[model samples]
Target: MSAVQTQPGGGETRYRIAVDTGGTFTDVVVGSSTGDMAVGKALTTYDRVFTGFEGAVRRAAQSVGWDGDEVLRNADVIVYGTTHATNAVLTGRVAKTALLVTDGFADTLLLREGGRRDAFDSKAAYPPPYIPRQLTFEITERLSAEGEVLTPLDEEQVRSVLRTFPDHGIEAIAVACLWSIINDVHESRIAELIEEVLPGVPYTLSNDANPTIREYRRASAASIDASLKPLMADHLGKLRGDLLQFGFDGDLLVVTSEGAVLDVVDVLDRPVLLLNSGPSMAPLVGAAAAPERETVVVCDMGGTTYDVSLVEKGVVRHTREAWLGEPFVGHLTGLSSVAVTSIGAGGGSIAWIDAGGLLRVGPQSARSTPGPAAYGLGGEEPTVTDACVVLGYLDAQGFEGGFTLDHDAAVKAIETRIAKPLGMDVLVAAQAILDVSGHQMATATRQAALEHGVDPRGALIVAGGGAGAMVAAIIGNILEADTVLIPATAGVLAAYGAHRAPIATEFLSPLHNDTRNFDSASAASAVKELGKKAKFFAARFETVNPDAQFSYFVDARYPGQAWDLRVYLDGAPDATGDAARQIEDAFHAEHDRRNGTHDPASRVEIITWGVRVEIPRHELLSDEVTVTGESVVHRHDPIVFGGESHVTPRYRGVTLSPGQHIAGPAIIDQPTTTIVIPPEWDADLDDRSNIYLNRKEA
Candidate 1:
C-alpha cells in the first residue's frame, strides 16, 4: 500500500506519477495540475518490487500532504522505468531458455562476431555466450543471403527437437534463422510450431524482435527478450495488480532505452526495450532542467553504478548498438536506443587495496540490503560512503528518509579494510578514495563527451542520482565545463524525467543501397511501410495525447565501412532523385562533423531507415522560490578537502531561496543528498530551485 495521510481538499485533482526502480533505490514522483511535484525514495526490495514501489509512492504522498491512495486514485498517467531487465541479464536470474538457430550456425552466439577490444592480447579470457552450447538446438532450414528459399524447413526434425523441451526443462525459446531479417518465412513457421508444441511457454523470433542486419546482435536481442519474457511479465503483472488495487485506473506506461514511454501491452511482448531505461531518463531530465543550455552531460551516480549520457543541442544521442554488460566483450542489442555508458563507481562501491598495492573502487557494490558500512546494516566492507563519512563529507544525521549514518562503523570499516592495508591513516585513506573515485568519474565523463563529438569546455553537466551532487562539481571542474546544474530532485531525477517524458515508439526498416545508384522507388516503399507501423503504434496513445509528432533518420556511411553514423532526414522518403541527394548531403555533413573529414566523391550507403513517433507530455512550470531569506550557515564542520582538514560551512537546502549565493568551502544538505562546493567555486539557486555551480575564476 501507499503512504497514509489525509488532505483538506477532496476536489477533482489530476495527477501524474512516475516510478523508477533502480538497483539500490525505488524513486517516485507525484505531479499535480498545479505544477507541483513531490519526490519519494525507498530502498529497493528485490524479493517483491511492488513493496518498495508502494513505499516510495507513499513517501512522495506524505511529502505533499495528500493521502497516497488519493494520489493514485486521481492519477491520469503513470510512467515506470526500471533496471530489472539489466540486472536480470547481469545476475543470470532470467528464465532457462533454449536457442534454436539454423542448422549450420548453431555457434553464432558463441562466435560473437569474433571482435575484441584487445586484439593482440591472446591471454585475455574469452567471455561466454548468454546461452550455453548445451542448450542450442539446430533447425534444418536453409535460406540464401538474398532471402531465396534454398531448402524447405524439415517439419519432422523440428517436432523431434521441440519435443525434448520438457525433458530439458526449458522455460522459453528463441528462434533465430539465417536471413530471417530479409524474409522471415522460415522463422515464422518455426514460431508457429513452437506454440503448437509448447502451449504456455513464450518464444521470440529474431525478425520480430530485432530486424537488424547482423546475425549475432539480432540473436542476442531475441535471446534476451525471450529470457526476460517470464520474469518481466510476472513483475509487471504484480505491479499492475498492486496499482489497480490501490485505486489507480489510468494509463500505465513503461519507459524504453530510447528514452520514450510506451503502453504496458505494447512493451510486454518485447521487454528488451526496457533495458537501460533508468539511465536514459537522466539525459531527458538534464535537457528539461537546463532548457537554455545547448549541450549537457547527465551523470547518474547511484549506489551500484555511475551511468553517463550526453544531450547535445537539446537532443539525446542515439545508438544503433548497445551492449548490456560491457561493450565489445558482452552481449550487444541491435535495437536503436539512447547511448549510455556505465562504470562501477558509486556510493556503495567498495574501496580496497589491490594485489598490486593500488587502491581501487568497485565493479562490485554492497547494494541496499547491507548498503555502506556507514548504514550499520551489518556491512563490513569499506565503501565510498564510508570514506565520505570518515572524511566528514556525509553528515551522521542528515541522511535521507531520516536514516542515520553510523560514523564509528564507517571509520572502523575504512581503517581495517582500506587504511591499514594501504599503510595510511583513516582520514588520508578516505581522501585518497575520494580522489581516485573523482578521477574515475571524470574520465568516464570525458570519454562520453568525446565519443558523442561534444566538447566538455562549454557543455553543462547535470549532476543526478544520490551521490551525483557530492562529486559533480569536482568532475565538472576536472573537465573545465561551463557550469554544473544540480536539480533539487537530484537524488530522484530519473523519476522526474520519466514524469515529463513523452510517449514514443520507434520503427526500423533495413536498406542496403549506395546513394549514387539509390533505388528511389524501393526506398520510398520501405519508408512508407515504416510509417504505417509508426502510425499504428501512435494510435495506442491517442486517448492520452491526441497529437503525436513524427521524425525520421537514416543510418549512412561510406561504402566498405564497418559502421555508419545516423543522419536525420528532412521528412519521409520520396521517389525522387533530389530526395536521395539530400540524404547523401546530410551524410557528408555528419561524417565531417564526427570524423573531421567529408567524402563527397565517395558513394554513401544507407543501411537502416527509422521512424519515431512521440507524444509530448504536459509541461509543468516550476514554482518560483520567493521566500526572501539570507544564506545562513547552519554550522561549521571539519571536512577534509584538497588533502587538508578545514572547517566547512554547511547549510540546509530548504533555507536557501532563489538568488541566495554561497561561496565554497561549503556544503548544502538536502534531505536526499548533499552538495559539496569546493574552494574557488560559487553556488546560486535559480528560480526553479536548481543549484548552478560555477568556478569563481571562470
Candidate 2:
C-alpha cells in the first residue's frame, strides 16, 4: 500500500470518518474542517456488515448535503472498529478450521485445564471445541521449555498431515506445538510444508500469534484467529475497497483490543486483536476527552452487554492476562485493560420468569431481531427496553420520533408474560425487572472496583449508551460515586471514540534472559529495535500527520513467577548499572500495586518489550453550552413490580440544560436510551451537557 502525501494546512480542507458496527445498528460519524458534523444509523446487516456500514456512511454524508464520494475524497483518515469478529466467535459463525498439534496434544482443546471450564461454577460445562477432534491432526515433534530439542521432529509425520489436508478440506490451518514459544522450528517447518501442499490456504502459528508460554491458551487463541480470519478478511477487504473506490486516499485504521489503532493490512494475521475493540476504545477516548481527573470509570451499555472499564492518569489500565481463556490459538501477547468486565445487562436483554417462579433478566438477549416488544416488531417477550416502555420510563409517542413502537403491545407482553404469572400488575412487573437489572449492573460495577482495589467513593463514573444514561445515576448511588458524566452523544460514544483515535501501531518482542545477571544494554537495544518497527508502521499514516511520535514499555515479572507486569520506561535502557536499577524499580512499583506488595529481594525478569507509535489527535473543546429550555416533567403512571405498583414520572434529558437538576422517582428520556433516576437520588446536568447523578444525603 502506498502512503498518501500529507496535505499542507492553510486553505486545505481535511475530513475524518469513523464507523462503528454494533449488534443492532451501524453508526457513522463524519467530521470536517468546515465545522460540520454528520451522523447516521442503519440496521445492521449481519450477513453483510459492510453493506450496512456503507449505507450509513452514505446517508450521513447526504444528511450534511455532501455526496458519499465527495466526503470520502476530502477525508484524510478513516478509522473503523467493529464487533464482527467477536460476534462471529460467540455465535459459532466462524469458518471450519483444522488444528495441527504435537502427537500427544490432539485432545488439548478438549482437555482444557483438566476439563474444568469454569472454576467458579462447579457444574459449568466445557464449551464445544472450535474444531472437532477428528480434524485435530497430530505430528511427532518434541521441544523442551528451554527451546532444546528433546526429540527430533518427525518431518514425515508433518508431510503426511499436509498431504491429507485436501481430504479434510480445511478452510484454514492452525499449528500449535507444545513449546512453540521457546522454539518454533517444528511449527515453522510444518507451515512451509502446508504452503507447498496447499498453496493458497491461510495458516496461523501459535508462536507467531502470541509467543507466550501456556500451550492450551496458545492453541485456543490461535484457533479463534484462524476460524475468524476468512470472515474478518472478507468484511475488511470490502470496506477498504469501497472506500478506495469512493475516492478515499487516506490510510484506514482499525481499533484493537488495547484501545490502539492498527493498519487494516496488519489485521489479516492478527484479527484476534479486534475482539472487544468496540468496548475498549470508548473508555480510553472518553477518559482522554474528559478533563484530567484522578479516578474514572466508564460504563458503556449497548444492546447486548454493559461493558465497564476503569481509567486513571489519562490512561485506561490494561489487563496483563487474557480473560476468556485463550479464545484463539496463539501465545497471548497483548495489553488489555485490566478489570474490563461486561455483563448481560443492556437495553435489549430479555427478561423472563424461570421454572422456579423467579424473575431473571438475562445472559440471553433479544438482540436487534424482533428487538423489544415495544419496537412493534412482533416480539412477544418483554425485554429491558420493553419494561422501560411499560413503566412510563420511555415516551410512547416520542420514541425514535414516533418511527415505530407498539407501546400497547409492550404493555400486553409485560402483563401476560411477567405480571400475570406472578399475580402482579404489568407496571409492577416491569419495574421489578428494571430494578433487578439495575442491581445486577451495580453489583458488577462494585465487584470490578473491589477486584482492582479501587475505592468507588473516589471514582468518577463516565456513562454512555442509550441504556447507560438511564441507569447512570442509580449506578453512581450504588457505588457511592458522587458524579456521573453522560456526554451529549452518550448513545454513540463508541463511534465518537473511533473518530478521536489516532493512527497507532504496537510492536512486541520477547525478552527471555534472566534480569539479575541479564544484559540491560542488550535488552535496551532490543527495545529500540522494536521502536523502529512501530515507527515504520506509523509512517503509513503520513497523510494524517508527518511528525507522529511513539511510546514504549516492557512487560516484566519477578523471576519464577507465572505472570508478568507492565512497566513504562522513560526511554530505552542503556544496559548500565543505573539503567538496570531503574528498570527494576519500575517493575517493583507495578508489582506492588497489583499484588499489594513487592519483593525487592527477588530477581526480576523482562518477558516482552513493546513500543506503540501514534499520531496524537486534536484535542476537543470541553466548554459547557447554556441550557435554553425548561425541565418539563411528564405526568406519572403506575408501574407494577415485586407484586406492587408505584407511579413513576418521566423527564427529558435534552431539554434539561446545564445547571438544571432533577430529583429521583423520575425517568430521564433521550433519543437513544432512558435513565431511571430512582427515588432518593438526584441528577444535575453539567456545563458540558453531561448528566451528573448523586445520592441524596440522609
Top candidate (TM-score): 1
Lowest lDDT block of 10, candidate 2: 325-334
Q: For residues 513-578, could you state the per-residue lDDT of candidate 2 as single tens digits?
A: 566788766676776788677777767667667878766777788867866777887765665556
lDDT of 2: 0.73
For model 1, give the 10-residue run with minimal summed lDDT. 2-11
The lDDT of each candidate is 0.84, 0.73
After superposition, candidate 2 runs with Cα above 4 Å error: 1-14, 54-74, 111-129, 143-153, 241-250, 289-291, 325-339, 520-525, 547-549, 619-671, 675-679
Q: Write the per-residue lDDT of candidate 1 for residues 1-698, one digit (tens) a residue.
A: 54433234654667888888877778888887766677888888888888888888877778657777778888888889988888888889999999999998887877676646687877776688888889998888889878899989998888898999899989999999988877899998888898888888999999888888878888988999999999999999998998888888998999898898888987899998988777888888888777677788889998888989888778888786687766677888778788888999989998988889999988789888788888888999989888888888887886764368899999999899888887888899998888889899999989988887788887888898989999888788788875788987898878888887888887878766668898887788888899898888878768767898888988888888988788887887674647678888989998897789998888888888888898887675356553436665779999888778889999988778877788888889876788988886889888778999988884
**Clashing residue pairs found in predicted model 1:** 3-58
- Most accurate candidate by lDDT: 1
Prediction 2 TM-score vs. true: 0.88
